[model samples]
Target: MNCPCCSGKSYEECCKPFHTKTKFPQTAEELMRSRFSAFAIPNGEYLMDTTFPAKRKLHNKKDLQEWGEMNDWTKLEIIKTSGKNLVEFKAHYNDENGTTQIHHEISLFEKLNNRWYYVSGKFLD
Candidate 1:
């Protein structure tokens, strides 16, 4: 299947490796893309797993999973990036009520031990 991240690559060659934990995203943008794929796949565990450890408390795995399942993830647009630790993107999806929505954010990432983790995001208009 084509990657939900719109990477123009097969899912296995694109985000599957990251989702399966066989490899980790090397940059914030890669992480962001993989996270979008995760939501499409509705893998809440992977979502929580990729979150920065320090900030994991603010998220609930079940909630993340349910949210993913509740939406139809359609596209991911990477607006910009700042070096390797930040990315601005828009995620388009349809909610449970069939309402189209776009989530725009500038996300911050942290790297430790050669792996990148999602730190946080500031929502945008």
Candidate 2:
């Protein structure tokens, strides 16, 4: 199947390695893409695992899983990357009501022990 991150590659060739922990994302953008795929796959465990350790308290696997299960993730659009730790992207999905929605955000990532972790995100209009 095509990658949910819309990387123009199969899931196995794209985000699967990252999702499966066989390989970690090398950059913030790659992490962002994999994170989006995680949501599409509704892999709450992966989502929580990739989050910055200190920030994990602000989120939970159950909520992440429920959010993913409630939505139909469609596409991911990368807007830009600034330096090695920031990524701006849009995630398109349909809500539980079947309303199309786009989540635009500039996300901050941190590299710990050479592995990128999602730190936080600032939502945008």
Candidate 3:
């Protein structure tokens, strides 16, 4: 499938490592790309696994599956990324109803076990 990040690359080439292995993203843009892949592929396990414990929402597999089934993510664009190990961006996608939505957030990340995990996000209007 075409990359949700609009990088003109396949999802496997773009974000599979962040979902499967010990590959850690060196930049916030990379992390955002992987997160977009997680949404597109319905890899809820990977999403929850990569999320920081403090920010984790208690979701059952069914719930995650339902979420995955409900939305079709179209694109992800990095607005900006900064800080020592933190970055934020605006992600865009369409819902099941085909209404486009934009998730603008300043996301936090923490490096652990030589990997980067999503910590938290503050939504912006």
Candidate 4:
């Protein structure tokens, strides 16, 4: 199947590796794209695992599951990036009530041991 992130690649070729931990995202933008893919597939494990350790506690599994299951993801657009540690993107999806929404976010990241972790994100729209 085509990648839900609209990366012009198949899910298996583009996002599955990251979801399975077979390959790690090499850049913040890559991580952000993979996370968007995770949301589509509703893989809460990859969502939580990629989160920064300090902020991981704020993300409850139940809440993640609820959010994951409620959204029907449609598209992902990367707006910009700052070096390799920050990214801004928009994730378009439909809610359970069939309302279209844009998750406009600017996200921060940190690299430890050459692995990037999602630190935080602020939604602007």
Candidate maximizing lDDT = 2
Residue lDDT tens for model 3, 2-65: 7667788876777776778658677656776787777778787877777766667654556665
As for candidate 2, its clashing pairs are none
lDDT of 2 by residue, 26-45 (tens): 99999999999999998999
TM match of model 1 to true structure: 0.98
Q: After superposition, how far is residue 53 of candidate 4 from its true place, in Å?
A: 0.8
Which has the better lDDT: candidate 1, or candidate 4?
1
On a 0 to 100 scale, what is the lDDT of residue 53 in model 4? 87
The candidate with the higher lDDT, 2 or 4, is 2
Cα miss at 97, model 3 (Å)? 2.2
Model 4 is weakest, by summed lDDT over 10 consecutive residues, at 60-69
What lDDT score belongs to each candidate, Candidate 1 first?
A: 0.94, 0.96, 0.74, 0.89
Name model 2 segments beyond 4 Å from true.
none
lDDT tens per residue, model 4, 1-125: 99888899999999899988899999898889998988888888888888898898889766776788899999999999988787999999999999999999999999888888999989895
RMSD to true structure for each model, in Å:
0.7, 0.5, 2.2, 0.9
| lDDT tens digits by residue: candidate 1, 1-125 | 99999999999999999999999998888899999999999899999999999999999999999999999999999999997798999999999999999999999999978888899999999
Per candidate, the number of residue pairs that clash is 0, 0, 0, 0
Clashing pairs for predicted structure model 3, backbone only: none
